[model samples]
Target: MSDPNGPTVRRRRLGGELRRLREHAGHDQAAAAAHLECSTSKISRLETGQGLAKAMEIRSLLDLYGVTDESERAKILKLHKNAAEVGWWEQAEFEEILPSGLGVYVGLEYDARAVQEWGLGFVSGLLQTEEYARAVFASLPLRPQDEIERLVKVRMQRQKRLTQANGPLELWAVIDEPVLRRPIGGPAVMRAQLKALAESAAQQNITVQVYPANKDVHPGLRGSFSLLEFGPADPRIGYVDSPSGNAFLEKDKQVRALVATFDRLRAGALDPEESATLLNTLAAEEN
Candidate 1:
């Protein structure tokens, strides 16, 4: 689906093609940059999709690589135009306040075709209700009330992807028992949140699983992570947040490991059907 990550994904796609063309022509990054009279960093950025390339710039590089095919050239040029478009978050003034790491994930999340998340803390951001979200944000102790509210607003806006016009983004989330049991925002908020969780799990595109806390050892004990699957043409993105630090994994090896891990977790956790029953039970127990 076309989403906030459109521009970023486009740049990366365009960059990959340029990189392939350069390599096939036997001109390394430095050589290509020298030939094009641009800095090597710019060449690097363009090939890695870290920055946008202008139409003229792309054409020039194509010409240098001897790409004379009109159709291929047109396709690449189209990518440039699409890449220049910005998503709603990018247009917001408050975007500057979001952490760079979080900002990157949020962009990717919006464009993802589906998200597979394992939550060890509270529920995944996509599943967080407004009151639950507010309470969780308030506990952070870093941002002021207004800033926290702004962050909450952003989270709420992002949830729209699950029910937006094009189609809902598929969600397969596995929550540990404690996640459903914990009363983050007090009994009322927790009860509503779990009720919402049960309802969300019922959606066709969403799958909710529960991992038992009694498991002696499990794949998820390593840590909580999320794997975002985008269009088949795009690479998968993996994210891990822990006390150690946060990382957004893009390399194939890193992503593959996380994907395998999530798979194992899904396999071990209670299936959506049983999970819904567990969720409802927990919600009813809340005061």
Candidate 2:
């Protein structure tokens, strides 16, 4: 079985532990930085899982945090060691195409058992066919043909987790109706994409819901977002990408709001069966 605790997740775990330890010791990032003789920004990065900490640094932080339990120290060190490893997405093939924010989001998604995604203007990447993805990328201004192909490959690779043996991602995607009718790559691409979408929806691990366009006002109107849940132990995280910028939301309040919004969106959308029917109807129309 593949280990779900990849480098990214380990980094996050180590950071969370360090943050907790620092808080418990009644010391702030400044104090931790002073103890390690590093800048506060470095401390912040380590605490937020954005940067890896050396073993010595981890030890020093533990000392500063007053963490005395040998077992706990060993655990933290192990996490640090594991966090140093590289994930598949970090490979050369995807290095240039996977933006930093998207890389982090992918890492989180890899560890997550399920994802609830709200698609506003496009089909969720997890549900998009290669041609459709290429068309979508090509539509963006200034995107070269090579970059478009690389991005499409990355998107397709991400879908592998859907069929992973140990644990497949349970995807619940709520898509907007217009996205299905948009004809991104033209009629042929739409037909193939919609047909593929219908087949994917038939899978046991996937659920599709189509939000009708007539419903003018909806909670997801704000933008497209995805909520990734890593089971009961870890808190869910929300991801949002827009024209302005992209962000990963970790606060309970922020995540909860997205959760509620997703619930409302799904509630207003066509159910799984109806959604599949719509996909089929759209595909046939393209014929």
Candidate 3:
């Protein structure tokens, strides 16, 4: 049940807290719903940040789950109040209910001290050129041109955080070799994109690596993911996106596994110096 109203940042935060409470209590959707006298589907929706949980309902659920810590209770209650607040994105008519995990993505991006990403099929949104972004959006059927432009602009805005005067985000990204070879909007657009990437890589806060097809082995072959290291305010979080939606790996075991995989992949990928050489070589070919 996607909410046409869209989720507010507060609602997203509450949803995340609810999920943590349920997981900590060892209760699945059915069990939690039974305790709350609601349908399991509703519980699932609330946990995923797709819908809001009534404050009273959240209170009852927390009490029933034996969550006794006063500090924790206040935090969850505060989140419920916050979810009622609106965000700037909500002002846009084209706003759709982004997956619940997307809230986590935004939250982490805002708070992360560092971020590492790897992409296999296309350029990561943070680094995508306007033409590249347009081409990617064009692949979707029936999107209004206005909405496409809005999205592109929104994406460009996100890059500002990386260039802010105060401590900008420390970003490291690696792309598969095929990503460079495929002309997203044709040679002209790709040439510019490659050149842009090469230039951006020179920034002290940014590191770009390339994993060539000839690499003997790499853990990234499993799929693309990101590891966001937060400041003391929050713990590290890992994210994996798929066509259906996204998943957050927060549990120690899962986060560790993904981190290990990323480490292995990084070791196998081209070093920064070598990767720059590869980028320059490809850019020359395009010219």
- In order, what lDDT does every prediction score? 0.85, 0.88, 0.76
Candidate 2 lDDT over residue span 192-216, tens digit each: 9999999999999999999999997
lDDT of 3 by residue, 98-141 (tens): 33456447545655678888888887777888888888887767
List candidate 2 segments past 4 Å from native. 34-39
TM-score of each: 0.85, 0.94, 0.79
Q: Which of 1 and 3 is ahead in lDDT?
A: 1
Scored against the true structure, residue 281 in model 1 reaches a CA lDDT of 92
Sliding window of 10 residues with minimal summed lDDT for model 1: 1-10
| Model 3 misplaced regions, further than 4 Å | 1-37, 44-51, 62-75, 83-85, 89-91, 97-104
* Of 2 and 3, the candidate ranking higher by lDDT: 2
Model 3 TM-score (2 dp): 0.79
C-alpha RMSD of each candidate structure in angstroms: 3.0, 1.8, 5.2
Reference-based lDDT, residue 274, model 1: 93
Total clashing pairs for each candidate? 0, 0, 2
What would the C-alpha RMSD of candidate 3 be, to one decimal place? 5.2
Global Cα lDDT for candidate 3: 0.76
Question: Which one is best on lDDT?
Answer: 2
- Model 3 CA lDDT for position 285: 95
